[model samples]
Target: MEFDISWILMGFPAAFVLGWLASRFDLRQLRRENRSAPKAYFKGLNFLLNEQQDKAIDAFIEAVQNDPDTAELHFALGNLFRRRGEYSRAVRVHEHLLSRADISKPERERAQHALALDFMKAGLLDRAEDALARLEHTPYENEARLSRLAIYERAHDWPQAVQIARLMHSHNQGDYSVRIAHYLCEQALGQQAQGQLDAAKDLLQQAQSEAPHAPRPRIELAHLQHKSGDPVQALGSLMALASVSPSSVPLVAPLMLELVKTDKRKPQVRALLVANYHSSPSLDVMQSLVQLDEFARVENADGPVGRDWYVEHLRHEPSLVAAGRWLAQETLSHEEHHPAVQRALDNAAKPLTRYRCAACGFEARQHFWQCPGCQSWDSYPPRRVEEQ
Candidate 1:
């Protein structure tokens, strides 16, 4: 065959032209698809911006169908579903993302976190807890632990709450010493309820060591001791608390006076109460002083020490509680109507004696270490509502 060099040269340019045309065609097709995807996305965004949730969801669905590998779109859809209270659908979306083998580690963890949130929003606490537990070694560990802590607290699982709180503390999350002490105190209360007095005592001691300046553990321990017929030990605990947590002294003053009477430590306790009263001038401490002085007068035939104390308190501060107390014991000319007048004074003083939570403002006749209203530990100040 004769060599055809002219034909070969002509065929090379023709083939090159064909290849260029095919490449251009393919690029145009790709550009069209890319443009369509963004158009659908923007349609969804417009619908969302217009508060047309149903239309927006439809647009997003179309976009996701067009690009099945869009992880960010899937996440957005899942969150939208969760926000709209469609938790089951949200869980399905996130779980589908998690089950995909092609997802990266970070994406998988994110999917898991999203699924946990879905379960949490749906009120499936057990499933949420399990999902959150799997995120412990991931970047979401701290957030997961905090959520888990909230879950355990809601369930009143003190041991689990304490464990998570300690982990967070070790990780430098925050100062959880006070919370840890509260947990221990809760555990002690549980043990006491179950008739495990010795175990309760040990837990309370551990709580005291955990937060030396916290008032709850010592106060609780004093109550336990008083219940166990060890008034002397109870008084000692109160005395220790007065030194360590002086701000809480008012909360325990009445109990301190009762312990003093029961334990025959009147003189020492009376001195301490008088000193605290002078320093803080709390109504509780004043009432305790009055009781102690009345008892002392009965025991030693001394004249009224507390009547003068109340009158002197009125001199320093114009306290309604102090005035009421002073008036209750005074002899008026209209002594026949004194009972009715005393009833009115007692009624007026009732609200001032309630303890209130600082975080939630929950008032109660008894003091609380944890707020029943907000489930916050140590939210209640160790002061009466009026004092606060």
Candidate 2:
């Protein structure tokens, strides 16, 4: 209480020295912690680059423990877990980050996306869908919508797929007209299966209107028409398709051949098949032309026979399939061995006739609008492997 200026001055200097020492100690400790966290993170990254996932995960765990509040560290660890197929751990880490209220908006969205990815990896589609739904209006909206589209497609929820596809198309994300058409076609098929012929026809017509140049809608519509006992209309649809998408003529040739019941339109059908064959020379179209020619030969004895077309095809291209087809119809000089030769040729030509996926190289006897192996649309070309 008494005035002690000398004592007060000594106490002030001593307090200043203590404060400086304490601050230096704290700064050193902080620097050491920062260095340790970075070291662990880098170690994890190095392990990952070396393809040592277990070591990388261990290192990441250490880094996360060293910096519990680091959102980026949490993200890295969660991603690592997801990549390692430890989806539960990945979910826990991302959920922990999401529970932290101190994270920024962007960080929260990022965590949400990560959590959705974890759910997807875990095959918790319902949960993944719910998580993805929350990402709308965020930066991850487009990606989330695409993921949801895949989920809808997988579930065969064509209506939902169509809705999402239309939304993406309207948003200028991408031209989903073809995809929408496919969804409509799928729905049409389902309707057709349920004997809702009129409804199926309506959906197919809408699909055609949506993507006029697409081949599947026309082909599907023709099939439905044929199924509905309107062979004439089906033939007309297929003929129009040949004009619109010439590359699809091969697909429609068999259907056209089946629908040709009247002798009056035989000439017109023959001309279309002949024209298509001249342009593309598809084996399927060639087969259709041969059948028509054989029918014509029965009408006029002087007309060229069906087997003559194979020779003409051979003149255009050296095709094993053509050779085999020609040989099958030919009267071989050694008739006794013909059966064995035919069997060998048929065996060799079988695989070449299979359609192959352009995306995944999955070969099938029948053509597919979508590759079953890769879940890719329009992956398989309309033509067979030999033509390719």
Candidate 3:
């Protein structure tokens, strides 16, 4: 056999030409497909830039239809739907992405997160809770847990909120001790409402251990003690609070006066209150002093402290509240018109007695642990509006 060297050389060139032509054809087809996707995408982008949301959605729909397998395009479309407040459509797109088996783990997690956000934005809390639970072991775990915590708070599910907070705390997410204490206090309040005094006490004790420096648990515990006819114990807890949180002395002063009156410990309580008042000069402490002195005057008809304390307070601060108190007991020269003048002074001073939230400046007649206006905890100082 000759082995045909010329034929072999001719066959090589023919095969090379065929291969080149095949590659060109494939490249042309790919370029056409690529060009079509970008043209639709740019049209959508242009519509979006022009603030034509309806037209942008139409262009995006066209682009998505042309490139149905593109995860990025689907994500963009889903987010657009969500931003437009079209929750149902956003849910559909994300659900479709989740149904695809070819989606990577990270992409699936992202899609799940997006679906949860859609439910939350649409006020479907039950559905959002389920979706968020599924994200627990994913990379979005922390964010999902935080959202779940917020949901639990809104639902007043304190135990579940505490569990999530503890988990986040163990993972070093942020300091949740104070929040946990608040949950315990809330649970204690619920128990108290149900006439479960012992259980409420136990929860409050736990709350105190959880956040030793927090004022709410101790304050609430004192209230419970006072309710149970144990004003002495209540006084003890309040004294502990004053020792630990000296700035909160004003908050406990009135309670101290009541406890002292009930227990016949006025002299010691008056001394403690007078020292604290001299140091801080709070309106609450001064008011408590007035009460203590008035009680002493009844016990002894000519007590020196009873009628002179308000004058001393006036000397220090020139306070309108102090002046009003002093004027209440004075014998004015125009006795016929004194009642009308006193009524006017009291009306003008009424607003000064309200409590104001430090965070939002929302004023109320009673104190609050959380600001109703801004939903912030520990925002209201334990003082009257005039004191602030």
Candidate 4:
């Protein structure tokens, strides 16, 4: 053990010098890489800020080429491609990032999300859905599920939409009960179309259970009852709807008026309409009350005619629709030109009958449970444009 003292003393200094040289080499290499990536990245960022998207993409592509291991550069390049509508190139970039063995967990999830977006933009919905499904348990789960829900709705797959909606609800994403009810209603409509009335009824009942206050299920059930030759039951359902959802009286009023054929339910239905109109004044409710009054006149009840009902409605809301409607029935002094004046006023008031979406400003003559422009469920208010 005493013979190697000289060699051991000399070897320590040699090893230290060798280590220092190696460290310097590594530092120099690292610095060169740092310079290359940052220069290209900053150039790309500058171009992006200037709104020169094509030039920004070129700079990012160059940065990614200079540092192939830089995941952030790849993400930037991939997102740029996607935003520019170059789905093929975006898919290639994101897929390349996902295929790498050394990508971090967060980066991998990001790549998966980017890949899904690329497929969605490319209109490859099946691929996009599969890519999004893999994001469960990750931070992107909520966003992934929301996109999946949209896909399910766009494809008219109510079962799948219901599945995702239940998952979202369980996770406390938002109040999805109404959304679940809408899915059930859509399923019921499908069953009804297939001549499966019993199945449809079961679905509607489930929907009502899911969202008890939702108006569509109640309204739809009344329609089904009426079609089944059970006008009494139909009238009962609408009455229940009016009682619970007074705001929707306008929507149910016409149906109530139609169901009130005999004098037995005439007073009850009339009283309900008047009560609802007093609470929530609307053009639809007013018109229905007028129809009920007209019925009373035909049945030799002690009520005034339809035109007088409009005059009563005008007292509460000062509605142009009510005014125009009343003018239509009155006999003007200039009788010869009354027809032209009435026609002009009626044409002007026609737009007041439309239903407009609260979410997207889409207007339609018919009220919708979903907004066609924005694809939002229950976006249209129960009231017509004039009442709104």
Reference-based TM-score of each model: 0.85, 0.95, 0.83, 0.91
Error of 4 at 378 (Å): 1.4
Question: What is the Cα-based TM-score of model 3?
Answer: 0.83
Off by over 4 Å in 1: 1-29, 43-56, 298-304, 329-350
What would the per-residue lDDT of candidate 2 be over residues 306-345, giving only the tens digit for each residue?
A: 7777898888888889899989878879899999999999
Which candidate has the top score in TM-score?
A: 2
Off by over 4 Å in 4: 1-30, 298-305
TM accuracy, model 2: 0.95
**Candidate number of the best lDDT:** 2
Error of 3 at 107 (Å): 1.5
lDDT measured at residue 187 in model 1 versus the true structure, 0 to 100? 94
Model 4 error, position 211 (Å): 1.2
Worst 10 residues of 4 by lDDT: 297-306
Write one digit per residue (lDDT tens) for candidate 1, span 1-388. 9898999999999999999999999999989878887888899989899988888888888888888788988998898899899999899899989988999999999999999999999989999999999998899999999999989888889999999999999999998988999888989999999999999999999998888898889999999999998888999999988789888888889888877876667877877777777777777887887888877664442332766778877777776677788888789998999989888988887898788888888899987776889987777776676666
Q: Please give the CA lDDT of all the candidate structures.
A: 0.86, 0.91, 0.87, 0.87
Ranking of predictions according to lDDT:
2, 4, 3, 1
| Model 1: colliding residue pairs | none
What is residue 178's positional error in candidate 4, in angstroms? 1.4
